[model samples]
Target chain A: MTATLTQLIPLTPPANPQLQDIRTQAAAYLQEETIPTNKNEEWRFTNLAPLLAQTFAAPNQQLPPVNINGLVIPEAPDSRLVFVNGIYAAEYSSIANLPAGVFVGNLAAATDAGLTVTNYLGKQPGGEEVFTAINTAGINDAAVVWLTKDSSYESPIQLLFIATVDDAAVAIQPRTLIVMEAGSSATLVQEYLHTSIPNHPYFSNSVTEIWLGDTAMLNHTRIQDEDITAIHIGKTAVSQSQHSSYTGNSIDLGSKLSRHNWEIFQIGAQTETNLNGLAMVNGEQESDTHSVIALTKPHGVTNQLHKCIVDDRAHAIFNGKVFVPQAAQQTNAGQLNRNLLLSPTARIDTKPQLEITADNVKCSHGATVSQLEDDEIFYLQSRGLDVETAKILLINAFAVEIIDRIPVASVREKLAVAVKAFKAS
Target chain B: MINPNSPVILSIENLTANVDDTQILNGLNLEIKAGEIHAIMGPNGSGKSTLSKVLAGHPAYTVTGGKVTYKGENLFDLEPQDRARSGVFLAFQYPLEIPGVSNLDFLRVAYNSRQKHLGLEELDVFDFDELVQAKLDIVKMNPAFLSRSVNEGFSGGEKKRNEILQMAILQPSLAILDETDSGLDIDALKIVANGVNQLSNKDNSMLVITHYQRLLDYIIPDFVHVMANGQILTSGGKELALELEAKGYDWVTEPQPVG
Candidate 1:
C-alpha cells in the first residue's frame, strides 16, 4: 500500500514557457528534487499526507474586491498598503509623504519601471522546496519596495495581504521584495490575514526577500493569522551588508498546518541582526518555524529568540541554527527557543544548533520546553485573577518580549487584539 | 449568628496542612478580628508560611484536617481566585517575576477581577491609571514602574513594595503578609509597612507572618501569637511580641502550663 501510495503521488513537471513563467520555473525545479517524505530532516515532525490528498486550484485570475474600511489601523492609518491575493490594490492602499527616491509598488510594475528584478529574484537559498517552487511559479503579483541611499522613512510601511476566495480548495502565492540602498533606514510590516470560515480548506504559499546595503537599517515585522483549515508555508530571506542592521519579528497565530523558514545571511563586516519570533497554536493546529543565521564576515553579531505556546492537541516545532565560518572571527551569535505546553496532550519539539569554526567567535544556543509556572499562576490568582485570566495574562506576557518590539504601533495593537480573541476562543 | 461588632475576621479551628505527605501546620488554631493586626512568629519549618499558603488555597499543600473561616464563610470551600475575590490576599514571601506582563496590565486585571466579583462596573483604562497612580504614592513607588514587566528586573525591595501595591489595590478584607520582611532593608521595610498601614481600615484585618519582630516594629500588630510545631503556643497583647523579641522563640516553645 505504501509503495502504491508513493507511486501515486504526482511529481511536479518540467519548466515550460507556455505555462505561467512563475509556475513553470517552480514545476521544473520541483520535478528535479524528491518530495520531502518523513525521511527528510526538515519533514520528520510534519506530515504532508493531508496536503497531498487535496486538489488545489490556482488563485482566481481576477483579483477579488476588498473593502478599505475593513483595513483600519487604530494607531497609524496613512502609512499602509493593501493587497488581495498577492496583487497590490492601490485604491485601498495609503502611503502619505514617502521619503525622496523611495519606490514601493507591485513587482511586475516595478520591473516595467526598469528596476533590477532579476538580480534579486530567486536569489535566496532553499528555493528548491516544492512549496517555494510552487510559490515562485504561481505568484500572480508581489510587493516590490526600494529605498534609495541617504533616505529615511519616519513612519512604518504597513502591508496588509488579505486572502479572500469564494471558491473551495484555492491557493495564493504572495511574493515580496524589499531593497534598502546604502545609508537608508525604514520599518515595514507585512500582515497575512484570512477571512474564511472554519473547515474551508485553502492554501497560501508566500516568499519574501530582503536586501540591505552598506550602513542601512531595516525593521521588519510579519504577522500570520489564517483560518483553521488553511495550510500556510512562508519563507523570508535577509542579506545584510557592512555596518548594516536588520531586525525581524515574526508572529504566527493561525492555520491548520503552518511552517515558516527564516534565513539571514551576514555577508559584510560590522553587520548586526536580531531575529525574534512567537507562535501560538491551539486545537489540532501544527506550526513549525525554522531559522538560520549565518555569519560569514568578521565582526558580525546575531541574536535569535523564538517562543511557542502549544495548547490542546496542537504541535509546535522550532529548529534554529547559527553558523560562524572560519574567516568570521570576532562573530557573536546566540539562539534561544522557549516553549509553553498548556495541555499534556500538546507536543513541542525544539532544537538549537550552533556550528562555529571561528575560535574567536562567541556562539551559544539553548532550547527549553516547559509548562506554565505554577508559582507564577498562583501569584496572579492570589491577587484576584482566576485560572483562565491568569493563564491568558501569563501567555500574553510570554509573547510580549517579541510583540513589544514591533516598530509599528497599529500592527502591534492588532496583534494584541488577536491574542485576546485567541485566548477567549 | 456572626457579630458585626466582633473584632476577629478570621478564625482557624484545629487546622492541619501537609506538603509532600509531611505535616506542616499540625492542629494549628488562631484568630484575628477587623481593625486589629496579628503576627505569627516561628522558626524555620515551624509552618508559619504554611498557614498563609493554606489560607490562600495553594495547591501544593493539602489541608489534612481543619477549618479556616473568613468573614463567616468556609475559606477552603472557595478556590484561590474566589478566596482572593472574597477579600483574602496572601503577600508571598518570594514574589514571582512575570517577565512579559506589564505592571499596569497585571494591576488592571487584578482590580477588574475584584470588581467583577462584586458585580460592580469595571474601571476603564483612564480610571484605572488614576487609581493605580494614587496607590503607587502610598508605596512611594515611581510612575515609571507601571510600564515595566511585572517584577522583571526589580530589586528585592521593589518586589515587596509591588506586592503591597497589589494588596492595596485589591483591598481585601483579610491580608496575609507571609514573610514580607525577609529580604527588605530598612527603607524598603518602612515603605512597604507604610503602604500596608495606609490600606488597613476598620473593616479589614492583617496577619503578619515573620521570623523577626523587626517588621512588627514598623507596622505594629495588636496581637502576637507564637506558632511552634504547627500550633499556636500562646496569644497575647502587643507587648507579647516585645517579650518574644527579647527572650527569643525558644522561650515560648518551651514546656508551658496549659490553660
Candidate 2:
C-alpha cells in the first residue's frame, strides 16, 4: 500500500473498550492488506485508479446545515436513524414508539443498554478483505439494530447515511450491524445519499452485516444514490439459519464509480433467500455488482435476479456465483443476470457462475445482454406511441420488475418516477 | 355497407414490399371506400400478413415500389405512429406480451395520442377509466385484466379480445385485422367479431384478412378477394369465401389451360 493511502487509515482509539480488541485485530490485518486494483480477479472489470490516486481526509466533525425534506420515508416517520458522514446525528433522529425487545441506536447507546454486539459484529465471513478490514479498523460508531427472540416489528426501520464535501475530499466508513433473534421478524430500509453538488468529490466505504436466527424473517431494502462525483464501495454480508427467510431489494442509481459486494451464506437447512438488484447508470459512470450465494445445507432455496441498464458511455458489470456442495443436496437455486444497453457505446459484462457438486440439486444460471428490440418498438409504434416514448416505456418496463418488489410504497413511487424520467442520452 | 358515393378510405396500387431481402408483397392492389368492409382470404405463404404489416409501416418491411393513399393523402408521408394517430390501426395476429406495462396505461396513452392528433382534448385518468369501462363490455372482458401487464399471461382468446377492444377504443378509419382469428376458439371468434361489428359504422372501414370462412360467418363482408403469390387474383362477393372454403384453395391456385 502507498504511504499516503496508509496514512488515511484512522488509528484513533475507540471511545468504548468493547470495540478495542476487534479494532486492533483489524488494524493489524490492514497493515498486510492493500487497496485492490484491476489485477484482482474480483475487481478485474472495475478500475480503482481514481480512488487510489486522490487523498481523503477523515470525516468532518462539524455537520453541515441541510434540508432533508424529501429524504424521509413516511412509513418509518418515528423510527428513523440519520447519520451525516458516518457519524450518528442524534438531533435529526427519531427513535420513539419502538416496540419492546428491539434496540436501535449507535455503538455508545448499545454499550449503555448492556447489549453484546461483538458476538455477531464483524463475525460474518470475508472480514479479512481489504476494504472490509479498512472499515473495521476505523470503526468509531455504527448503526446497530437488534431484535430479541420472537420479537416482531411491524414498521420498517430507516437508516439514512448522508455525505457532503464542502472543501477537501473526505472519506467515511459507515457500518451497520443487524441481528434478528430466533423467530423474530422485521423490515429495514438503508439508504446512502448525497447532495447534488458538482466537482466536490468524496469517498464512502460502508460495511453491513446481518444475522438471521432460526425461523426469523427479514426484508432489507438498500439504496445507493450518492452524487455523481463520489466514489462508493459497500459490502453486505448475511447469514441465514434454519427455516429463516431473507429478501433483499437493492438499487444503485448514482455514483461516478461504485462497487457493491453482496454475499449470503445459508448455514442451516430449509432456508429461503430472494435477492433482486437493479443498477441504472448513465454518463461516464461505472458500476459493478458482485454477489455470492453459498449453500451448505440440504433443501435450501435461493432465487436471484440482478439487472443493469447502461446508457450513454456508462459501463456495468455483474458477476453472480451460486455454490451447491454435496452436503446441500436437493438445493434449489436460480440466478439470472439481465442487462440492457441503451446506447452503442454503453457496455455490460455479465457472468453467472453455478458450482454444483450435488447431482440431486436443481440449479440454473443464465446471463443475457440485449438492446431494445425492433419488434417491440414497432409494436408500440403501432399503438400510436412515438419512437422515443416507446423506448422509454420499454426501458421503464425492464426496471419496474425489480422496483415493484420494493416493500415501501414511497420508495417504489420515487424510483418509478426516476425511472420514467430517464433518457438514453 | 358499401356506398359508391362514400369517400375512398384507402387505395393501394401495385404496392411491392420486402422483408429481409425476401419480397413479401408483389404489386398488390386494393381499394376500400368508407362504410365498406373488405375480406381478403389467401392460402399460406400468400403475403396476407405482409400486406397488413406494410400498411402499418413495420420497420422490418421495406417498400420497394408503388404507393398507398389513405384518406386521399399519401400514407407513406407519415411515420408509423403518425399513421396510427391519423386513424390507421392493425390488429396483430400474435400480440406482444409487454411485461410491466399495464393494459389500462397502454390503452390510455394510445387513446390520448389519437385524441391529440384529432385536436380533441385528452382524457384524464378518471374520464379515461369511465370510457374504457364502457368499452370493456363490448368484448365482455374482465376489469381485472386492466391492472395486469399488457397481453401478459393472457390466453389466446383473451389476447384476441384485447385486440378487438383496442380497435373499439381507437375508432380508426382504416382498421386492418391481420389474422385476428388465427388463435381464437369458436366462442372467442364470435365475441371478437361481435365487438368489431359493434364498432363498425358508415364513417369507418375494415379490411379483414383471414384463412377461414368461419370468421366471415360472424363478420360478413361486402367484398371478398382471393390472394395468390403476394397479389390478389380474384374479387367477388361474400359467397366467394364459402366457395374457397368448400372447394379449397386448389381450384383457385391451379393453372388453367390457355383459353
Candidate 3:
C-alpha cells in the first residue's frame, strides 16, 4: 500500500493534459510577477512569508456534505446562494420570487451559457497584487447576481460561503459580481464562516467586484468570523457612475491571519460612498485592513471610519488613503481610524493618507491609537464595578459607535454576542 | 451631647508632599472629627489643594514624609480605588470630562463600590437608576444630564453639581471638597453648598478647602482653620471665617494666635 501510494504521487509534475496546461500557465505567471519584497511600497510593514511558504492546492471537486441549518438567516430573503469549497450547493440555495430579468447563478454556468461575463469578470484592477492574480487564475466557480435596469428589489440577497475541511490544506476562490443598473436598488450580504474543527488550517481567498450604473444604490455587507486557524485574504472593488450611491459595512472577527482590501473608484459626478468597518482580534490573531477611495470626477463625496480593538498580544493594522484628481473639484472625503489596545502587548498601527490635486476639494484624514483612559476606568470602578468590568464597559462603549452603524439587525446582534462573549472570557 | 473625646475620623500629621520635586505641602497637619465640618481658608500656594489630592491618592503628588490616617487606618497603604471604597471622597476642583462614560453609570459604579466594600448586596440596574434619580434632586441637577457622558461638555456649575451628586450617591464618611466653589457662579455656589450641607450628617464629616469664605456662608462650618505656608496658623469657630473674609489672609496670617 505504501508503494502504491508513493507511485500515485507524481515524480515531477502531473503529465495529464489539463493539469499540465494549468501548471505551465501558473508557472509562467509566477515567473512574470515575482513575489513582492520589503522594498515594495504597497507591501511595506506586511510580511507575506506565511502566505508564500504554504503549499497551494486547488479546492476539492466533491464537497463534503454540510448542514445548512446552522447557516440560516432568520427571516431570510427570497434569493440566497450557498457555496462550499468554491462550488455552488444548489440544494442549500434559494432564488424564489426573483424579479424579471434578474440573473443569479454560478459563474461557470453563466459563462457556458454565453452570458455577459466579460463585461464584469477581471474588470477590476489588481495592480501589483499577486494574491489577487492567483485568485483570478484559480477561479473555477463563483456566484454572480445581476439586476436589470429600473428594477428595485425589496429584500437583500444573501450569499453564504463555508469552509469545513481540517488539516488537508485547500484554497477557496469565491468571485462575486453585483451589478445594479439605472434606478435600481438592492442589498447584498456576503458572509464567510468556517465549520472546520479546532487546530485545522485552511486558506480562503475571495474577491468581489461591484458596479453601479446611473442613479443606482447598493448596500453591501461582509462578515468574516471563521476559525482562528484559517488564513483569509479578501478584496472588494466598487465602481459608481453618476448620481449613484454605494455603502459598505464590513465586520472581521476571527482568523489567524486576515487582511481585507477595499478599493472604490468614482468614475462619474455626484457619486456618494460610505464605508465603515470594525475588527476585533484577540489571542495572538493578526488582522490587517487596507482601503483606497479615488474620486476621478467632480462633486463626489466619500466618508469612511474604521475602528479596531486588539487584545491579548494580538495586532491590528489599518491603512486608509483617499485621492482626489485634478478634475475632481468639489470632492469631499473624510477618513478616520481609531484603535484601542486592551493588553499592554497588544499593538495597533494606523495610517490615514490624503492626496488631493483639486483645489476646491475638502479632504481630511486622522488616525489615533491608545489604551483605555485611566480616569475612565477609575470612574467606572468607583461606581461598584471591578477593574476588569470597568475596562470592558469603556471598551464596549468605544466600539458601540461602529457597531451601531451595521444595517443588518441580525448580523449586528450576532456581532454583539461575539463581543460580549469575548469580553466575558 | 457630641463626644468631645471622640476618635478622629481623619488625621494628617506633618504631611509633606511634592509634585515633580517641588514641595507643595510642607509639614501640613490637620484633623477632622466624625460630625464636624472643618473649613480650611488659605491664600495661594498654601497647600490647601495638595492636602485634598494627597488624601484622594492622586498619582501626581508624592508624600515624602508623614502619614494620613482615615478611620484609624493608614490611608497610604490603600490604592485609590480602595481608599475610595473605604468612604473617602474627593470632589475634584475641576472634574475631568470622560466623553463616553454615562453619568448614571458613573454614579452607579461609585455607589456599588461602597456597597461592595461594606460587604453589602449590590443594586441592580433598575434600583441603581432609581437611587441615582433620588440623589439628583440633592444637587438640583437635570435628569437629562444622567444620559450624557460624565462631565462632558458641561458648564462649570454643572460639573460641580455632578461632583456633589456623586458624593450624595456614594455617601462617603469623610468628604473633601477641593476648591469646588472656585468656578461657580453665585447661583451655582449656593446650589453646591446646599447639596454639601444636605449630604453631611452626624456619621459623615467634611473638609472644605477654599480660597474665599463665600462657600462657608451656605455650609457653615463648626470650626475654621487658616492655612498658611502649608501649616494651620490658627483654629477658631465660624467667626474666624468672618475675620478672614473681612481682613483677608494677609492680616491674620501675620503673627496671629494659634488657638
Candidate 4:
C-alpha cells in the first residue's frame, strides 16, 4: 500500500505554489493513515479487500481518441468541461456561452483570477480521510466553477470525467471545487463515465467540495456510471451559509463495487438543504451510500430520500445520519431510505439515524425494505398486462419517483429507458 | 334490456372456491342472458367480493370445484390478462393506487390490448387521446385527471368515476361491479350509473354486487338475487331488491315456515 501511494504522486510539482503546499502536507498525512478495512464502523458493510489486493499506477497524461456524442446533454451544450483520466481535455471543452463573472475551466485557469480560489481550495472539512488525502496528495489540476456575486447562469454547466483504461490497471483521482458568491445562482451537473466497451479494471478516487454564500441557490446533479469492472470511491462535501438553498441529486448505476460519502454542514441559520439519491445494482455488484447532515443554527430545514433497487445476487447498503444540536432550535428535518429487492437472493441493509438534542426541533426518520407486492402485480395484470410487463411497470414506477425530479429532460429520458430495461436474472 | 331470444353470456355451475385454506364460495350457481343486468344482495362474509375476484382470476383465490363458462369458453383455462383481453372486466371495490403511472397511459394500454385481441389496428397517441377524451365526458371527469398518477390520492368519487371511464373504454361483453357503489354518495352514484347505462347494449351483460338498494334506483336491474352462506337463497324480479332493503339481511338467513 505504501509503494502504491508513492506511485500516485506526480514527481513534478504543479506551477501554482498554493497547490504545491497542499500536496506536501497531504503527503505527510498519508504516512500516518492507511486504507480502511471492514472492521471500521463506517465501512463494515463494504469490503475493500478487492481494491487493496492490487497495485495501481497513475494514468498517463496522453488523451485517447473516443466518441463523446452519446455523453452530451443538449440542455448544456455550450457550457461544458471535459476531463480525461483526471486531466482537462481542452480540445473537447467549450466555454463560449458562459456569461461575464462566471469562471468555468480548470484549476490552472482559476489560479489566474488571483487568490479568489485559494480561500476555498482544499479548505472544506474531512480532508484527513485516507482516500480524500490521497486525492489531495496527487492534486495537479481540478474542474473549478466560480460564480461571482449576483451572477446567475440560465443554463446548466456540465463537468464530465471520462476514464479510459488500457491493459494495465491504473488509478485516477479527480477533483472538483464549486464556489457560489452571495446572491449568485447556477445549475451544475457532474458526471463520471468510462469509455472502454469491455473495460479493464481500474480505480477512481474523487473528491468534490461546494460552498454556497449567503442567499445563494445551487442545483447540483452528480452521476456515476463507471464500467462494471471498476472500483469507485467518491466524497461530496457541502457548506451552506445564511438563507442559502442547496439541492443535490445523485444517481449511481455502475462499478463492481462503489461507495459514496455525502456530507452537508449548515454554517448559518435558516438554511435549506434537499437531497435525493438512487442506486440500481444487479448481477454481483455492491453499492453503499453514507450521508451526514449537521445543523448548528436555528430554523434550519433539511429533507433526504435515498432509494436502491437490487437484483440477482447484488447487495446495497445505506446509512444516513442527521444531527440537530442544542443550538439548532426550531429545526425541521426528515430522512427516509426505501429499498426494493427484485430477486430472492438480493440483500439490502439500511440504517437511518437522528440525533436531536434541541427540545424545540421537529425530526422524523424511517427505513423500509420491501419486495414487489403481489397485489400491485395482480392489479396491473388484471388491466390486460402480462406478468412480465406488470413487473417492469412496477419497477419503473418505483424508480421514476426519483428520476422525474431531475431537471434535465434528456437525462430523465435516458434514465427512464435504462430503468425499463431492468429484469430479474 | 333482457330478451328471451338473446343467448346466455355467462353461466356458473356449482362454483366452489377458497382463499388461504378457508372456503369462501360453496356451490354457487348463476346464469345471465345477454343484454341483462343482474343485482346480487348479500351480507358480509357471503363471498360476494370473492366471487368477483375468482372470476377475474385473482391469484389469491383458488377454484376448488365446479366450472364457469364465458361466451361458451372455459373461464379458468385462460390467464388473468388473457381473460381481461377476451372481454371480461371487473370494477374493483377498492381500486389500486399505482403511483407514478399516468392514468391516460394505463387506459391506452388496456384499450390497445382489447383492440389487439379483436384483430383491430391499435390507435396511436393522438387518436387514443381523442377517444379517451370522449369517454371521459360520460363519467363527468375533468381532463386534469389524465395527467395524474392512476387513482393516487383520488377521492372515493373520483376513483369510482375513473373506473366507469375505463368500463366505457373497454366495452367488455361481461362486466362485474364488485360493490362499486360501496363508498360513493348519491351524486357520484348517479354519474357512475349513467356511465354504465350508456355502455350497456344488446350484446353485453352486467353483474352488479352491492349491499344497499339505493344504487338500484339508478341502475334498475332486470333481476335481483338474495345471497346467504355463499349460495343463492332466493331469486326474483327487481322488487326483490326493495324487499331486501325493507326486511334487512335477517329475512334471508332466517328459517321460515313452509308456505
Candidate 5:
C-alpha cells in the first residue's frame, strides 16, 4: 500500500451501534490499503491514474425528490425502491403488496429489532476488495432485501439508484444486500441511472451481496447506464448452497470508465450458475469485467458467456476464472468470451482461466477478439441493404447473441434500440 | 410475346478480374439473351466460382479490365446493393450463417428494397407471410425455418434450399447460381432444380454454374460452356454436358494444335 485511501478521503461514520463493527473494519482496511495502480495484474489494461488524481467527496445537499417515472424499466415492477445520492428516497418509491415474510427497506432506517442488517450489511461473500472496502466504509444508507424461507414472489422487484448532480466531483457509494432463504425464488432488477449533470464527474462505488440457501433460485439483472463523464466501480458477490441456482445478467452501456467484478462460490452440491455479460462501449470510454466462479462441491454446473462490442477509441477487458477443487467431482463448466472491434483504435483484452484439480470434471474456456467479418457485411449488402444499413444489421446481430439471453423482454427491447442508435452516431 | 430473337440482357466483354492479387478471370467473354439458361461447368479451381462472385460485385475482387452491361447500363458503376436492387441475385454456394438475424426479417428487408425500387407497395408482416407462404412451394421448405437465424445450423441441403427460397422471394431478372448442387443429395437436387425451373420465364435469364451434369438433367440448360484456366474453351448444347462428363475434364485441358 502506497497511499492510504482512508486518510486521503475523510468520511464520518453515522452513529449506529448495530453497524459499528462493520464501520470499524471498513475504516481499518481503507487505511491499511492503497488505491490499485496499473502495475496491479487485475488493473493492467485499465489505468486508474486519472480517476485517482481527481478528488472525490460525497455530494452534500438535500436529497432531491427525483421523479423516476421515465427512468424505470418498462412494465414497471410491482415493488420498487429508489435511492438518490446513496440515500433512500421513499417519496419516489412504490412497494406493491409483498408477502408477509419478505422485508424490503433502507439499511439506515431499519431498526436493530425489526430487521437484522448488521450480519450481512457490509459483509460480502468475496471479502472486501480495494474499491469495495472504500464503498463500504463511506456509504451510510443502503438497500437491504430479505426473503424468509419458503417465500416466493412472482413479479420482479425493481431497485433504482439515481445520481443527482453537484458542482464538484462527488463519490457516492450505494450498497445492496439480498438474502434468499431455502426454497425461495425472486427476480431482481437493479439499475443505476445518472442524470446529465454538467461538469460534475460522479464516481459511483456500489456493491451487491447475494446469498441463496438450498433449493433457492434468484434471477438478478444489473444494469449501469450512468453519464459518460462518470466513473463506476461495482461488485456483485454471490454464494449459493445445495441445489440452489443463480442466474445473473450484468450489462454496462455507460460511464467514461467502469469496472464490474462478479465473484460467485458454490458452498454445497448440485448447484447451478449461469452468467451472461455484455459491455457496449464507444468513444473514449472503457468497461472491464472480471468474474470468478469457484465450485467447492460435486455435481456443479456453470455456464458463462461474456461479450464486448467496442467502437471508436474505446476499450473493453474480460477476465473469467473457473476453479474446480478436488471435491468438486463431475463438474461441468463452460466459459466463452467474444469481442468485436468497430474501429482500428478500439481494443479488447480477454483472459479465460480454468483451474481444475479434479480429473473427472469437464471444463472448457475460449476467448476471441475480432472485427466484424468483411464477408458477412458483403453477404448482407448483396441482399440489397446499403452499406450503412448492412453494417447496423450486422452490429445488432453481434449484440443479439448476448441480449437474447436476458429474461426481461422490455429490457431487451431497450438495449436493441440503444444499439441501433449507437451505430447511427 | 413469344419472340425467339430476344435482345441480350447481359453482355460481358473481356471480363478480367483479380482476387487477393491473383488473377481469376482472364478476358472472359459471354453473352446471354433474355429467356436463356447458360450453364458453365468446369473442374475445381477453374474460376467458375470467381465469375459468379465477380458478377455480384464482391468487394474483394478487383476488375482490371472489363465491360459488363446489364439492361444497357454499366454494371460496374452500381454498388453491390444497388446491383441487387436492380434485379441481380447470386445464390451463394456456401451461405454465410448469421446468428441473430431471423430469416423472415432478412427476406422482408430484401423484398422491401426491391419493391421500393420499382415504386411498389411494401408488404407488412402478415401480407409478407402470405406472399412468402406461396413462394415456399418452390422449394417445399418447412415454415419453421423462416423463424430461425439465416442459414444458421442448417444442413447442406437446407442451405441450398434457402438460397432458392431467397431467389423465389426477390424475383430477380438475372439470377446466378454458384455451384448450388455441390453438396446436395439427389432428392434435394431435384427440389432445387425444380424451384429454378418454376421461377424461370421469358423476361428473366438464368446462369447456372455447376460441376455435375445431374443438375442440368433437371433444369436442362440451353447452352453449356466449358471454363478452364479462367477462360471458356468451348460452348455447346445440353448434350455437351454428357460428353464432358463421359470424357472427363482432361479433354478440355489436353494439349491442342496451334492454329
Candidate 6:
C-alpha cells in the first residue's frame, strides 16, 4: 500500500520485548506531530515538497552484489557490515577476530550476551520528529555495536548501507545502535551509499543512536554520497556520560535532496564534544544541516565547525543551536558555519544560535556566506593557473577544514579526490 | 617606440591610467632594455606602484590612453596569465595569502606552466621537488616552508622571500619588484638583495620600485629615475638613489629648472 508518515506502518510482532513500547509510542507520536512545512521557522529555507510529494512504499527488495567490487575502506580492516536495502548481506561482509567482550555482527541476529542495547535503542533526542518517528515505526533490522567495560578496538568498525533500486517508491529505514561501557573506546565509520535506478526517487530515512558510558570515547565518521536520484534524510543522536568524549566528522557530497540532523546531549559533567562537517552540492541538489548541543551539566566543552560549498543552482542550509543551562556553569562552547557560493545562482542560508543561561560560561556562534573572491582568483591566475583550476584549488581548501580532520588516511584521500571531481562536474 | 630590432624588453609611451575614478599614471613613459637594471624612486602617491600594475595588466587599473609594447608585442592585448607565461612577472607589494595549498605544489604548478608554454615537458613531483629545493637556496629559505600553505601565516619578510624564490623558478625576462623592501629588516633585506642579484643576468632585465635607497645600495641599479606626479621627473645613474636618500623626496617634488 502507498503510505506516508501519517499512515500506519504494518510490522510483525517485536522479537525483542524491549522495543515494543517504544514502537507504540513512536506510532502515537507520529499521529500528534504534523510534517514540518516551509512556514515553520526551522524549515524556512528548505522546502520539503520534493520529499513529501513522493508516494513511498515499503522497502523489501534484495540488493545485488555490485556494491562490494569498487567500494573499499583501508582504515577499517577489522570488520565490515554491508546492509543492502536495509538488510544485512553476509556474503559481501567480513569480521576479523575481536576481543573477548567486543561483539560485531548483525542487529537482527540478536546475541543476548552482549552489552545491553535496550536502554538506548530507539531513544533519540527528537523522537517526535516526523521523519525520525517514521524510521522508528518501520525499522525491523539494524546494525548494532556493543563494547564491554575497559575494552578498546584499535581498528575501525565499518558499516556500509547500499540502497538498491526499489521497484516501488520506497523509503529505506536503516538503524544503527552503538553502546560503549565505562572506560571503553572505539572508532566507527558508517557510509551511506545508494546505487539508484534512474528516475526511481528512492528515499533513505536512516537513524543512528549512540550511548557512551563514563570515561568512554568514540571517533565516529559518517560519509553520505547518495546518487542524485535519491532523497537522504539521516539523524545521529549521541548521549554522553561523565568524562566521556565524542568526535564526529560528517561529509555530505551527493543526493538530490538531503537533510542531516545531529542532536548531542552532555548528560554528565566534564564531557567534551567536537563536531566537524562539510557539505558540497551542485545542480539542483539541496543539502541542509540542523544540529543541537545541549549541555546540562557543569564544565562541559564543545567545538564545532560546519562548512558548505554550493554550486550551480544548488542551495545549502545550516541551523546550529547550542544550549547551556544554569547548571552548566563554566562551560566553553563555540560554533561557526562558513559557506562558499561558486556561482551567481547558488544559494546558502545559515543560522547559528546559542541559548546560554549560565553567567560564567563562554559561548560563541557565527555564520559567513561569501562568493569566491576575484582577488584570490587573480592571485592564482598571475601564477599561470587557469581560472577553473584556481577555483578548484580554493574550493578544495574550503573543504579541507573538515576533510583534514579525518584520521583515516584512505578516507581522507578519497574525499580529496571526490572534491576535485565534484568541482569539475 | 623603441626599435624592435634592438634588445628592448619593455617600452611604455604616453601611458594614462586610473583606478576607481582617480588618475594614478598620466603620460608615464619609460624604456627598458635587456641586461639593464632600472630603479624608480618616488614619494608616496607618485604612481610608482601603479606603473608596475599597469605593466602587468591588473584588471583594476584601467588604461584610458597610450600603449605598452612588451617584447615588441602589444602588452595590453595579453591576459595577465599570458603575460606571465611570456616572461613578464610582477612581485606584488603585498602578496596574497592562499591557505590549504602547499607552497611547493603552487610553485611546481607555476613552474610547469611556464615550461609547458615553452613547449618543454613538465617535470613530475619527484623531479620538481628536487628542482624547487635547489632554488630555495636563493632566498635562504628553509625546506620546511614548502609544506605550509602558500604565504599563509608567513612573516612579512618570508612572503617577500617566497616572491623572490618564485622569480628564480620562473626566470622571467622582464621582472618588476614593486616595493619589495617595504617590510624587511636588515638581514631580510640582504637576503632579498642577494637573491635578486643571483637572478640578474645579461639575458634578462629588472625594474626595481622603491621609496628608500637602502635596497639599491645592495642590488646596484644601472639607472635611477625620480618620479613625482605621474611621470618620471628626472633620470640619472646609480648615484641619484644615494642623492635622493640623503636629500629626501622634497627635491623631486619641486619644479626643476629648465635645461
DockQ of 4: 0.69
TM-score for each predicted model, relative to the true structure: 0.90, 0.94, 0.84, 0.95, 0.95, 0.93
Task: Report the lDDT tens digits of candidate 6 across residue range A29-123.
Answer: 87667778888987888878887787777665455555566566876656778888787787777764666767777765544655456667887
Per-residue CA lDDT of model 1 for A343-366, tens digit only, reads 899999888888888999888889
**What number of clashing residue pairs does each candidate have, in the order they appear?**
7, 0, 6, 0, 0, 0
Q: Is candidate 1 or candidate 6 better by DockQ?
A: 1
DockQ, Cα level, model 6: 0.66
lDDT tens digits by residue: candidate 5, B1-259: 1246998889999999999999989899999888999999999999999999988999999999979999999999999998999889999989999888999999999999889888899999999999999999899999999999999999999999999999999998899999999899999999999999999999889999999888999998999999998999899999999999998988887776578
How would you encode candidate 5's per-residue C-alpha lDDT over A1-84 as one tens digit per residue? 434244323356565656667767876876667778788998888877657778776666468666576777755455788988
Question: DockQ rank, highest first?
Answer: 1, 2, 5, 4, 6, 3
Error of 3 at A331 (Å): 1.2
- Name the lDDT of candidate 4: 0.90
For candidate 3, what's the RMSD?
A: 5.4
Evaluate every candidate with DockQ and list the scores: 0.83, 0.79, 0.31, 0.69, 0.76, 0.66
Fraction of the reference Cα-Cα interface contacts (below 8 Å) that each candidate reproduces = 0.92, 0.79, 0.33, 0.62, 0.79, 0.60
Interface CA RMSD of each prediction in angstroms: 0.7, 0.6, 2.8, 0.9, 0.9, 1.2
Model 2 C-alpha lDDT per residue in residues A1-425, reported as the tens digit of each score:
55656655676778677788888888788778777878889999998888987989987667776667799899997788888898888877888667779888888887788888888888899899988888887788999999999998888999999887788898879999999999999999999998646778888899999999999999999999888889999999999999999999989998899989999999989999999999999998999999999999999999999999999999999999999999999999999999999999998988899999998988888999988988889988998999998998999999999998998999999898889777755
lDDT tens string, model 4, B166-215? 88888888999989898998899999999899888989999999988999
**Candidate 6: CAPRI quality band:** medium
Candidate that scores best on DockQ? 1
Off by over 4 Å in 3: A1-31, A65-81, A89-118, A145-158, A187-189, A282-285, A310-314, A341-348, A417-425, B1-8, B11-29, B59-78, B109-127, B228-231, B250-259
Candidate closer to the true structure by lDDT (higher is better), 3 or 4? 4
lDDT of 3 at A132: 64
Q: Where does candidate 4 stray beyond 4 Å?
A: A1-7, A15-17, A113-115
- Docking quality of model 3: it rates as acceptable
